[model samples]
Target: MKLDKYTVGKRYGKALFELAIEKHEADSIYQDLLKLREIFHEVPDLGDILSDVRLEPYEKDEIMKQLVSGFEGTIENFLYVVYNYSRMNDLLLMIDEYERRYDEHKSLLLGTALTAVPLTKEQHQLMEEKAAKLLGYEQANLINLIDPDIVGGVIIEANYKVIDGSIHKQLERIQELLLK
Candidate 1:
């Protein structure tokens, strides 16, 4: 059976998360993982270099060591293992999975709100409150996604569901019905 990247990542992430929690370093480890994600985003080819089979294992280890030198203990050791297995390509997925699992454990809900333009602070807060209530989460962390293509309205995604209030979606639905 072939496991997808997410499945593989989730397994590793869950293990790391559990270890961090046991060690009382969950928050610190999660922060380090978030930093790693930011680094990955800033250096798009870092993943490629880590995952590139053409590179010798030693070279990959050196790269991993340099990148993760600041992190100690669990996170550093975890990165070393990931590099040893040539799974650096899965690092981002693993970080995301780790964050999601951590949030679930903490009773926090992370969501995204996509709109044609940036939302005002008041609008954002109101949306977050509504999303929290709708999802039955004590609090909601909604990140704003400015998408001009949405054409107006907002699309809220949380708890594995998408609530599309975008005019673009509305128009598409209308067009589909008319065509039918």
Candidate 2:
């Protein structure tokens, strides 16, 4: 039987997260995972090389060894496990799963603030506070996303909900009212 990418990610990522928590290395693992994700994104072909069937396991191990040279054992072991199972291509999915778990562990809501322009530091802080309050979370991590078409105001996308306060949405609502 074969597992889908999402399942594979959930299994491996959850295992790793649990291990990190048990070892009291969650923070370290989190930082390393972020760096590892950056590396994979910047050099996508690295995953292909690791997952290539033609390469002997030893060869692949050597490459992974180099990649995890300075990283902690948890990361290296996790990479090897992923490679051995031929799930190299789903590394990003695994990272995302791990991040989701991390956020939950920290009681955080990760959200986006979409606006016509970039948010100032003060505005970003305020949005995070407001998002936390509106979403009923103690903490929120908001990333500012600029969408010029919004035409001002802001749209908050968080926790599978969209708070559309943008001028574009307001205008559309008015148009619908007029038509009615």
Estimate the Cα RMSD of every predicted model relative to the unseen true structure: 3.5, 2.1
lDDT per residue as tens, model 1, 111-140:
899999999999999999988888787788
Residues 1-180 of candidate 2 have per-residue lDDT tens digits of 988889988988899899999999888999998998999988988888888999898998898888888775888888878888788888888888889999888879998999999999999999999989888888999899999999999999987899999999999999999999
Give per-model TM-scores: 0.77, 0.86
Q: What is the model-wide C-alpha lDDT for candidate 1?
A: 0.89
Task: Give the 10-residue window scoring lowest on summed lDDT in candidate 2.
Answer: 70-79
Model 1 TM-score, 2 decimals: 0.77
Q: What is the lDDT of residue 51 in candidate 1?
A: 86
Clashing pairs in 2: none
